[model samples]
Target: MSATREDVGGTPLPPGWAQPAHQPDAFEISTTTFEQRATETMARPFARRAIANATDHAAALTTARFVGIDHDALRDKARQIRAHAIANLPDYLDQWIDAAEAHGTIVHYAADESEARRIVAQICRDEAVTRVVKSKSMASEEVSLNSALEAIGIDIYETDLGEFVVQAMGDRPGHVIAPILHRTKDEVHALFSTMAGRELPNEAEALTAFARDRLRHAFLTADAGISGGNFLIAETGEVLLVTNEGNGRLTTALPKIHIALVGIEKIVPRRRDLAVLLPLLTGHGTGQQITTYVTMVAGPRREQEPDGPERMHVVLLDAGRSALLGGEFEEALHCIRCGACQNVCPVYRQVGGHAYGWVYGGPIGAVLTPLFRGQVEGGELAHATTLCGACDDVCPVKIPLHDLLLGLRRRRDEEGCVPRSEQLAFALWGQVWSRPLLYRASTAVARGSLRVIARDGVLSAKAPLLRRWTAGRDLVVGRRRS
Candidate 1:
C-alpha cells in the first residue's frame, strides 16, 4: 500500500505514491502467510524468467572472472576481513567517528530505525529541503525514510533507474541489486507512456534516454542527496559507494548537502581492505572487476576539492545489529550484500525476491529479516529457504547462511511462532525415527498410505494440508528391496 498523507504525517504525499503491482505486506509478513506470497509470486512468469536470466548471466560472468584463479581463496580472505571487522566493530566505529570528525564531517548514531528516520528528517527540515534526490540504499529502505521525509512535504526522487522505475510504479523492489528485476522492458515502457501521454517505444535505448533526461534534471536541481555505503572505512572515515551506473557519483557530487545512511556493520578497519572487498563484491554481485563507479567520500568535500557536497552527514544505523555483535548469528553481519546468495538459491530463483516479503530478500533476507525483527514479526521468513547450502557456498563473505537460517527456524519453533500442526508433525516424525520398531512400522504404514493416493510412482495430494507440498512436485516412495 502507498503511504497516505495521514501515514506520513498530515501533509500530502508527492505524485506516484499509489500502491504498486507487487505490493507485499512489507511491515506485516503475517498478514498473508509466506506460502500465499510465494505461490502468488511463482505464478508470475515474467518475474521467474527475469530472476533466472539474471542469475544465469551473473554466474557465467563470475565463472569467466575466476578462470584458473583461486576464487575460493579470495572468498576465504574476504570472509576473514569481514569477520575481523565485525568482531571489533566498536573499536572500528570509534576510530571512524574520530577520523570523520577530524575531517569536518558530522556523524550521527541511530540506535534504531525511528531515530535514523528522525535524524534524516530533521536534517531536511533544518536545511529547509524542498526537493531531495537519492541513490539506491537498502538502509534507507529499512527505515522507510522517503515516506518520513515526504510526509513533511519533502519531495524525494530515486535517482537509480531501477529505483526510479520502482518508485514510479509505486512498488517495492524485487531484488536488492536489481530492484526492478521482476519488471520487463514492455512494462516499463507502458509505465512511461502513461506518464508522458505518448506511446513510448518499447526499447532499451529509448527507455534509457527517457529516464536519463528526466533524472538528469532531478540530479542537477535537488536540494540534498541521500546514498547508502557499500563500505565505510574506519581508518579514513570514508564512505564507499559502488554502482554500475554513474548516478551515485552524480547524486553525491551535485547536491550541496549529502547524507549517507548506512548499517553499522558496513565498517572495515583498514583502507587496504577495499582491495579485497571491492573486487569480491563486484565479482559476486555482478561479475565485474569492479562496479563502473566506486565513489569514495573521506568526509564531504575538502577545501581543495573542486566539486562535491559542502556538508556531509553519515547516519550510522544500528537497528538490531549492535545486539547481534559477539553472538552466534554475528556472522550474518559479515555480509557484503553481494547478493550472491540470492542468485544461487533455488527457492529464490523460482519464487523471486518478492516472495520473501520484506526489504531484504532471498536466503540472506530470510536470515536477517527474522534476526532483526524477532520471531513475532519475521519468523515466517525462516521457512522461505530450502536449506540447500547453495547460498552459503556462493556467499563472498562465507557467511553460513544455511546455518543462520536453521537457527532462525529453531528460534521460531522455540518461540512458539511455528504453527501447532507443524510442531506436532515434527514431534510425531521424531518419535517414529527414535524407535527402530516404530520406524519400520511407520515407514510401512506411510508407504501403504501413500499407495492409496499414489498415481504412477508418486503421491498425490490426498488432503487439503498436503496440497501445499504436492502442488509443485510429486513425492515418490522408493522401493523397499535392498
Candidate 2:
C-alpha cells in the first residue's frame, strides 16, 4: 500500500508489522529529571555504545565533508539567512500565505497544539479519509499527530524505513536524522522476523528489503499523506523538503490529499536561500553534499502534470514559537534542524535524545524544550548540558547554543522552577563565596574533608554531599595522597 521507495532511494514491511507495540515512544519526554533518566540510559551499555559510535562517525563525516569547501563562510551566510527570516517572520508568512493561496494551496493557522490537531483531523474527516501514509515529520511528532489520527480511527502508517520501524516498535526517534541510532541491527532483525513469522537474514540490506515490500503496498492504498516542511519559500509559495530516502516524494505525490505541518520558523523569504541552506542542512545532518531527493510543492497538480496530489494543505503552527520572536531566545528559531549539534554534544552522545524528555534532544533541544514547552515540563533539561561549546562550533546556522542553554537556566532560576533546595544552596553559596574569610575557610575545610574521603586523589562514588556528581564521574583532585 506504499510508494516504490524500494526501487528509488530506499531498500525498504505488513499486518503483523502493524501489531500493537509494547515499547514506549523512544522520543517521549520522561517524567524524571535529566539525572534520573540519564542514569538509566548510562546503565544500558549497548544503547550507549550504539549512540556514541553513530554520533562520532556522523560528526567526523561532517568535518570531512567541509574539508575543501569554505565551510565557515557557508555557515555564516546560513546564519544570516536564518536570522533575517526570523526577524521578518510576520511579513514573510503573510507573503507566503498570499502566494500559496494564489497558487491554489489551502493554508490553516494553528494557535497551539490543540488547534493544529483539530485542523488536521477535521481535514481528514471532511475528506472522508480512513487510511493515511506519512513521511518522517518532526513537526508532526512535535504536535503528536499520529496518535490523534489513530484516536479518530484512521489507520496511519509511518512510511520512512526508520520511522516505519519506530512505528511498528512504538519507539520515538532517537536522533534527528538517524531515528534508531540507539538500536542495533540485531534488534531490527528480531522485530522483522517476529513480524514475518520466519527467520529473516541478519543483515541491513535484507532487513530494508523486507520493510520496503510491506510499505510499498501502503503507499498505493493510503487516502492521504502527512509530512513536514524543511523550509518554506515565501516568494514561490513552495514547501521545500529534502530527503535521502525517496519516501518524502511519494508520500506527498501519490496521495490524493497531502498535509504539511510546518513550524512558522521554517519559512524563508526566497527559494534561492536554499542554495546556501540546503548544503549545510544535508552536510551537517548526514555529511552528504546534498540529499538525494529534493521536492518542492507549490500546490496541487494541474491537468498537464502526470502525478501529484489533488489537494494540498499547509498548517502553520505557532505553539509558543511567536512568543520568542522578540525575546532573548529568538536566535533558537534560527536552527536548521541539521542535528549536527546533537552529534557533537557530549550530553546527547552519552544519553541520546530520550533523556531530554521532549521531542528534541541535545543542546538545541535543551534550549527549545524550555522555550517551547516552558519550565514546568522542560526547564530542568537546561542543566542536561555541560555548557560545552561543542554544539556552538558545529551548528551550521551558528546559533549560540551554549549561551541559549545558560539563558534557559537563568530563566528557570528566575522563575522559581528550580527546586527550593537548589535555590537555597545557591544562596548559601553566594553568601560563602562573596566573603574572603568565609570562602578561604570553607574551601580549606572542604578540601581537607574531600582529601580524607578520596582514594588516590579520586573521590569515591559515595562521596558525602557530592554523591550525585561523583557517581557518574571521577573527580581527580590532585596527585598527592591524603
| Model 2, TM vs. native | 0.91
Q: Which parts of model 1 are misplaced by more than 4 Å?
A: 1-30, 435-441, 444-465, 474-482
Candidate 2: RMSD to truth: 3.7
Which model scores highest in lDDT? 2
Please tell me which predicted candidate would have the highest TM-score against the true structure: 2
Give candidate 1's error at residue 120 in angstroms. Answer: 0.4
Q: Under the 3 Å rule for N, CA and C atoms, how many clashes does model 1 have?
A: 0
Number of colliding residue pairs in each model: 0, 16
lDDT per residue (tens digit) for residues 1-482 in model 2: 33232322222334434545654443345567787778877878898999999999999999999998899999999999999999999999999999999989999999998799999999999988888889988888888888888788787878889988888787778888888988889999999887666899999999999878776777887889999999999998899888888988998889899999999999998988999999899999999999999999998888899999899999999998999998899999998898999999988999988888778989989999888887898998888889879999999999999999888888888897877898899899999999999999998888888888888878978777788778767787764346
lDDT of 2 at 297: 90
Q: Candidate 1, residues 48-98: lDDT per residue as tens digits?
A: 788899988887787788788888998899999999999999999999999
